[model samples]
Target: MITAPITLSQALDRVARERPQAQAFVAPGERHDWRAMREQSQRIARALHAAGVRHGDHVGVLLGNSGVWVQIFYACAMLGAVTVPVNTRFKTEELEFCLKQSNVKVLLTADIFLGIDFLELLTQVEPALASAGGLPGERLPCLRQVVVLGERCPAGAQAWDAFLAAGDAVDDAQLQACIEAVAPDDVLLIQYTSGTTSFPKGVMLTHANMLTNAWAVAQRIGVSADDRYFSIRPYFHVAGTTLSILVSLMTGCCLLTLPKFDVADALQMLDAERCTLTSGNDTIFLMLMGHPDFDRSRIHLRGGWAAAGPQVMQKIRDVMGVPGMCNAYGQSEASPNITLSSFDDPFSLRAAGWALPHPGMQVRIVDPGTGSPVPVGEAGEIQARGWSVMKGYYNMPEATARALGADGWLSTGDLGEMDADGRMRMVGRLKDMFRVGGENVAPAEVEEVLHAHPAVRMAQVVGVPDARLGEVPAAFVLLKDGQDSTAAELTAWCKSRCANYKVPRYVAVVDSFENIGMTGSSKVQKNKLRAHAVALFGLEQPA
Candidate 1:
């Protein structure tokens, strides 16, 4: 096995030198081999350097899944600059807040995508971008440049082509100096975890933290240079950047990226590329296998990965023919990989949502308040200690102190239980647990039961305020296309399968749930769901 690259720039350089002709990235209009990817990154590095971005400086990026996104990331590596991947779905307030909080010096964004003009949006967010030279102020003092990744750049933005051209004068010696100054332990990426709360915390992951976790994930999947992956996970998330993109680069595998997932298109791409591996959240897999045109015979899916309820993971393996699919679980703070179930694991272990822990990671199920280990087979907050743990939350010292302990264990804020066999099962998120008449209801457990219904494509359970019970479980469900089921019927199904109190008292069968309210890892924003449920039910907000 090739040793992991110490710095991300080294990963690009080493791969380019060793496999110059191997395909590194595959997209609809653009394809780059290892050498070409490295060269493009150099041009981007020059462009960024010319834009006045320097080592340790934060360069914010807002774009969809594209080759340009990958190019910008590596460009930051080439200059020891920090890459802050902003969620493309951000609105005016969120965009302004993230740029200001991260102290972004340069922002690389798309001119037009998904029918929204991003340059116009930026102007609305900062207002300073209305001029040829963006106004500097307390809100965005460090922000000096905004580079648009398209033609006809806005007044305050640099055109994509012009940005590349400006890099022509940057000498190799200057670039080398920047790259050499980087170390394995230096912060490489600041990935913000999207929360229902107004402010999202920027998780600071060093090169070592991300690369080591990526290496472990690659090892578990047994990826190789010969592998071809149909990648659809959003590039803004760690699931996309660290697991999918970094794994492809680490193993010299070819990755075909879909800017947005289309079931038919994804299937066609899988067959066209003869992809050996693919991965996404449970919802993505459900959409793929549940598609009317889905056929197991049409594609090559040797293996893949999923982080969902065990039943969903089982369906992914059984239905998609990737029987070797692994189960992964973690939060963004741990470079997003805590435990990954191996393909060779026993059905009991895999089904229980436990696999061998990633190397160098220490996990424990401790009482949330006492910080003491819970008895085996008992649920508690999961804590992690290792290289993968993020350094801290950027500019949020109080939040960081609350998250990470002086003992080096980072409280994951997730609830799980480890069995005597050393396998662990995720119960649910601590915050998502609701009590109906003083009985604890883990929303995930109920959602798992709801998923068992053949007609249910997606299900989210939230707590609604109650004058009598303090709170009652309410479900917002999305049914499969061309399938029919009513709230009454689904409520009956749940009541039949679970305890009386666990069954949702209220069910709303909606055409579609709010996808924006979900986190990148496919977790439902229960807080948002709860608020929606409360409003829909006309219940008074708890004082």
Candidate 2:
């Protein structure tokens, strides 16, 4: 049974008391038990406090999926500090924006990643930080300290190990007492949105919010201690941290963490670890299916978690070796998950699963034109209300008011349908739908047919203005490494599978997509693609 406070540190203490020797996390050659995790968390908590971190203070984490990240997260929970995990993929300018916006006082990062010197990036951004109004004499004013995670600490940074060693062994009783003081409603983490439109908005989540979502997901998926979880999603994402780490911790399951996502490496890890549960976006699933050694019989589980088109789900199960897979629909504002398919519901494997145990969470499909609830089974805007909803966007009251209604429902900005069983079938984004010759066209429906093509690797659809039709659907396609297809050929292929009006009138083939940082979960930055499409094919004139 869950208890009050709902703090991560409290949960870890419970697990330590119940199952001290259980393997909590497994990395390359390192392993940690519940007892060790608790101890490390305490030590890190003492170090953070000694560094002057206080309740409600924001600490930034810019490291990868090392055990240290987990320790830092739990340590913050113990110290009542809020953690702001920045994506390591961010450029110097992007990092500067988040650092300033979050008002971060301390930064924990590695010296390098994939051979790129992060210290060099920090140096380049130092002047920008000063221009942004950092304090005098401090390289980064709001940033009081920098802890390096890797082999050697850079000249201006402190060593992570040295800081941990500087603190005395924390008293277990005192640590437990501190955990008891945290409230379930206290802001625990701030997950920045992908910022498809403009700058990212920080999604403020509380202990109760995340705990409820994780518990609901575990119940819906039937995850137990017997489940061996393997994940490549960056821990900075809510899916990796809340679902993978918190859920695993609560259920006493074994967690296998991969530093990064590589198709071959992911396949090998799943096989070696005998991973029974995994989750990812459509692109990652497609990449895994293309790997040579992907086989269902090796590590088949109840079902994997995903969020994509139904056709993509089917292909993953039939073509890849994964038979049991499910789709979940959510956003960062809702702690990342609101709906999930049951393992027994075979039909849901093809749809974006049913709403989970957040029975208090209300779902409504409203007509895009009138903002009225649509009839059952008809596609409309998906909105939600309940405990899972975030408190509000950090420091953006106007935007927050617009997103969350006075009655407390969140406008998800997604188009989907609720079936007879209350299951959700996501059609596309509301902004992605366009009208052509007075008929509504959903780009996702069109993209699904295009993805069925043998040579197609991925596809994105948008509407470009046309002189005759007002707006017409256009497709941006990516092909397999050595495969090729002409615009006419792909258009003809889609014509055979979809309505003529829904078929893309203009097609552009590209080798890869532009990098747009994702939210905690791996949802695409659709706004970026929309802008790119406008530039590539002039929105003012038809091709």
Candidate 3:
């Protein structure tokens, strides 16, 4: 029987007691067994306590995926402090917004990682931090201490060693008391949304919310203590926090961490470590399979999950030799996992992109216009209510009210369809849907058809202004290696496969959307694609 953990501290302690000597975390040159994980995280908790972090206090973690990140996360949990993860891809403005909005008291960051200098970025955010000796300025008044991990510690920031030693005087009994005070309903994380359409909002999640959701995912994926899980998801994202890190901790599985995603390094690590499970999006899976170094025989993967369409899911099973791969669907506000196909599910259902809702989550497809539940097999907005729903958006009551109803159902603002058996499949975002001479068209539905093309590797579609039709579909495509397709031919292919209104009126062949329309998590930014399409096609901006 799978007993769900209420608090993260309880989960950590349970796993530590059950698998004392088993490996819990593994990276290139580092390893932390279950016993060490408990000890190390407790030590960090002591240090954080000495730094004056208390229950409900917000602490920011600005580092890559490493043992240190895991230790810090658990330490904050031990103290009942909320963790606000700073995205590595954030610029000066974005980083400052996160720190200021979350009211972070202490920040732990790295000097340099993957050729990016975090110190330089921090200096841009606050010029006085370089000379104020960890003192806060007007811009960041709540920030009391800046802890630097690398050798080049700034003038005002505390060094890693000194920070760790600061809590040597803190007793174990005091730390235990703090841990005991933590409740299941206490907010543990304030995850920021990806901001594809608007400024990012902080999604407040409690211990019970994330822990139960992670347990559901682990159960569905058949995760066990013996499984070696390889995940390239960034630690800053909710998927990394709940699905990867928390899942491994709860299941006593060994988590394989990568500071950054590189095709060569990922391929080599998967083969060498004999990883049994993995996770990624459609773009990530495509990049791995398209790489010349990818050898199916060398890969020992048995099962995993993906946020992909039917075309990509089919390739993951048939081409990549992962027959147990399942399709996944969710957003940050739902603790990320609303529905996921079980590893034991039939391949046909998995390939068709059908997924069963997490055991405790209640899912409904509702009309975006009237808030009425849609019939099964009809497309509508996806809303969920249960243990996985977020508490609210932090400090944004109006936005919170808009997303969450009084009855506790969260309006996901995503388009999807459900079948008679309670299986769900994502269609597209409600905001991404475009009207074509009165007919509604979902870009995802059209993009899926484009993905079926032999030469097309990836496709992104947007609604561009048309004089005759108000708006029409425009597509940007990335072709497979050594393959060629013109705009006209691709348009013809889509025209033959889709309805007249659904087919893209204009198609542009592109080499890559790397920095142009991609997010840090590999999701396409449809809003940006729309802006780009207008400029490239010389379409007039809507009034």
Candidate 4:
């Protein structure tokens, strides 16, 4: 079946026209019907176009996961502009790198978030933009304007409402025309991968790519208009952006959003809203388990089993009173989810599950050395071919080519085994990366965070063996001349900056790091570091 090319905004309009009085977006005390959301998105689109944003132009959204995030995403879709959502946890330097790399012309952000003033950071980075002044605004090179969301507009930033006043009101006809102009192959969003290095690579996702993934998820989760989706993941990530926001909009489901993840608050919302379907990374599941109000009676899954350890699963059933749970697996490069355990399968809760049977999506296990397909029940590299595969990394052709083969299959770089029953069990990563409590703790991502410490001159991170978690991050640091900071101090600093799981469990101060081998780019060889961590921490062999 050939699906029609429907831009995100068009999807919202359809829902509004069909379910005008139906509740759409819910957050705190705020609620918007489908019709209201559609009109607001149109107004925002007009406001964006008036600020000089156009088709294919990058519009940076640096806000948290709030109702405004949905507005910005749909508004950009309505205008055919590519949205670039930046991670809210990023430091000033990290934020600057993403903004400069994407060549974002317009930025929409909040004045303050998590006790940090984003406006002050923007001002500090403004002078550095002088090096690249070919774009319209010399002040920020490609950045021509900034829209401050919420009530207070920061100094040197334009009020969001003021910008909306200059543009003509947009109607359904205008939105429909814009949707007609948007081809399925057009780039929809530039999602930045949380790479370990100083710079992040933008994963270019096409409209078809995202739509296919969302459709697959809807099918797996049995999404419908009656489903209420609680969006706890950050909108900057694929899990929240495509799976939560885009999927809800496309499937005509109601979306409940949270600006931040708070276990107590989330439980209250789930109970009050009676959320039927909730999805997030493993960390979210763990957080839910920790809440005092966590009980199976509070949750109502449609047909899937909630994935967790047996003890956690029992708690969910006993406390929240949910019947079933299922495990899900995917990566940013795969537009997020490729496989989900089924509620009907006997081992569904134990395994990562099976790939959804979407059109043009294929999964195979191949021996890494010989590039030959591995037999069933044997571990090998997991490769996939699907409409959900990303178009490529933005402006990084070499990396793109290496990731996606000429045969159209994308090597996931993840090692897994397919059982006789066709269920896939992930073994480990072909790369040196490892997961810390379900989050992809790339040694590089942690190492970069360590290097940011004022007392540290250089640092390296690697996954070490853990008794409970499969692996935990460990760090080796070299202090600057005459500077001294205890391992506890450094670890505490990282905790303040990044997620808790990303903090190093063990730290050591080293005088020098032996350069065993260097890449063509002169980056330190991470394999050597991994080996050292294994030797020092005595990592256990995989059974």
Which candidate number would show the highest TM-score if scored against the true structure? Answer: 3
The per-prediction CA RMSD against the true structure, in angstroms, equals 1.8, 3.1, 1.4, 10.3
Give a tens-digit lDDT track for model 1, residues 1-543.
Answer: 235538898888878899999999998788989998898889999989988888899999888888879989999988889999988778888888899889899999888877778888888777777776665644678888888887657676777888889998999999999999999999999989876655899999998888888888889888988889877988889988899889887788888888777788898889888988988777788778778778889868877677778767777767777767777888899998888887677655665578767866788899998999999988899999988999999999999999999999999888999978676767788878889899988988888899889898788898888888888889988887789999899999998999998899899987655443766445567788887788888889778
Candidate 3 weakest ten by summed lDDT: 1-10
The 10-residue segment of model 1 with minimum total lDDT is 513-522
lDDT of 3 by residue, 493-519 (tens): 998999999999989998888657667
The sequence of per-residue lDDT tens digits that candidate 4 reaches over residues 343-409 is 4545434333444434556788998787799899887888888777888888889989988999988
TM-score rank order:
3, 1, 2, 4
Relative to the unseen true structure, what is the C-alpha lDDT of residue 485 in candidate 4, on a scale of 0 to 100? 95
For candidate 4, the TM-score is: 0.76
lDDT of each candidate versus the true structure: 0.84, 0.77, 0.90, 0.72
Kindly report which residue stretches of model 4 are placed more than 4 angstroms away from their true locations once superposed: 1-5, 128-140, 150-155, 169-176, 196-198, 300-320, 347-357, 432-543
User: Which residue runs does candidate 1 get wrong by more than 4 Å?
Assistant: 1-5, 135-138, 520-523
Candidate 1: global Cα-lDDT?
Answer: 0.84
**Residue-pair clashes per candidate:** 0, 2, 0, 16
Is 1 or 3 the stronger prediction by lDDT?
A: 3
Q: After superposition, how far is residue 185 of candidate 4 from its true place, in Å?
A: 1.3
Overall local distance difference test of candidate 3: 0.90
Candidate 4 lDDT: 0.72
